[model samples]
Target: MSVLRIDTSIQGPRSASSALADVAEAEWSAVRPTTTFVRRHLGAEPLPADAWAAAITGGPLPEEQRTPAQRDAIALARTLADEMRHADAAILALPLYNWGVSQHAKTWIDLTIAGAEKGERLLEGKPAIVLTTRGGGYGPGTPREGWDHNTAFLRRIVADVWGAELTLIERELTLARVNPAMEALLETAELMRKAAHEAASHAGRAAASSAR
Candidate 1:
């Protein structure tokens, strides 16, 4: 089995979402020791800014007619889509940025969709886990309720459009430890973080079992 892990956290090692993804990947590796792992660190090496637009416009054009940049863009999209098509399971680590999806993640999604062949859902029915972290609370009744603008969009693309069997592991109040304004919520933040890790591990185990 193969698992594709896509990391989209600008914070790198300090990123809570990335750490949670590691926990899940560790659990997955525990059960499937020999499973192939493919890592794509988008935060470190984001796709070309113009790749999505080029791909969308050039995909249907004849290769000979496409500009060099367009060709490169199309190729990049195909590579990204191929990773999804070949993976048995996938993990996407995303940190909410300004209550919106990261440009890198969105670019990847757009390119993937543009590259997909007709009637092809590369990740159809595949197990896909999304690890998301937010610096502030956006839960119901919170002052920021309904403030998250990315989760639903992400679901629409990955679950609805790509048809992946989805699971979400979310952690909020992530900035409580560092943000003075959230000092009062530090204890709750710790608890939420711990729970998120546990949930990630559980989901990872479930993914491994399902793979078998």
Candidate 2:
């Protein structure tokens, strides 16, 4: 199984959400050492429109864009899509930016899903887990929580657009319980890791039996 680990944190490499995601990914990898892995750090490397347009249009070749700055844009998008599809699982690490996904990640999402031929979501059918670190709580039943947009938007994108099974791991401490939050994160990752592994194992057995 291959796993695509996408970190959309705007804080570059120091993002807390990305940090936790790395841990979860490592755990998953340890369980399945042969799993192939690919990654996209959206915030650190924003998606370009020119390359995106070229790729979507399939005209003039994305590499022919002219100025050297446009370099690698087209190839990156193709590589990103290829990586996503080659993987059997995925991880999205990011924070709730203004109650929604960061602009960087949003761009990647647009280029990835928009106008890709039918039956094309690299994310489709994959077991995808989202790791988040929020500065406040946004759970349902709270008036202010309704203000949150990440869950609603991401849910639609992951389930409807990508046809993927989605899980969420969040650290929302509006009242500041630092240690407990870390512990909770660890616990959640453990559960997610176990579930992913068991599912893969079950699928393997089923496939073996069907081969008879």
User: How many backbone clashes are present in model 2?
Assistant: 0
**Maximum-TM-score candidate:** 1
lDDT (C-alpha) at residue 146 in model 2: 81
Tell me the deviation in Å of residue 189 in model 1: 0.5
> Model 2, residue 146: displacement in angstroms?
1.2
Query: Where does candidate 2 clash, by residue pair?
Result: none
Query: What local lDDT score does residue 115 receive in model 2, on the 0 to 100 scale?
Result: 37
Q: Tens-digit lDDT track for model 2 on 157-211?
A: 7767887767766665422334564555555545544554444444333322222
TM-score of each: 0.97, 0.68
What's model 1's lDDT at 26? 94
By TM-score, how accurate is candidate 2?
A: 0.68
* Runs off by more than 4 Å, candidate 1: none
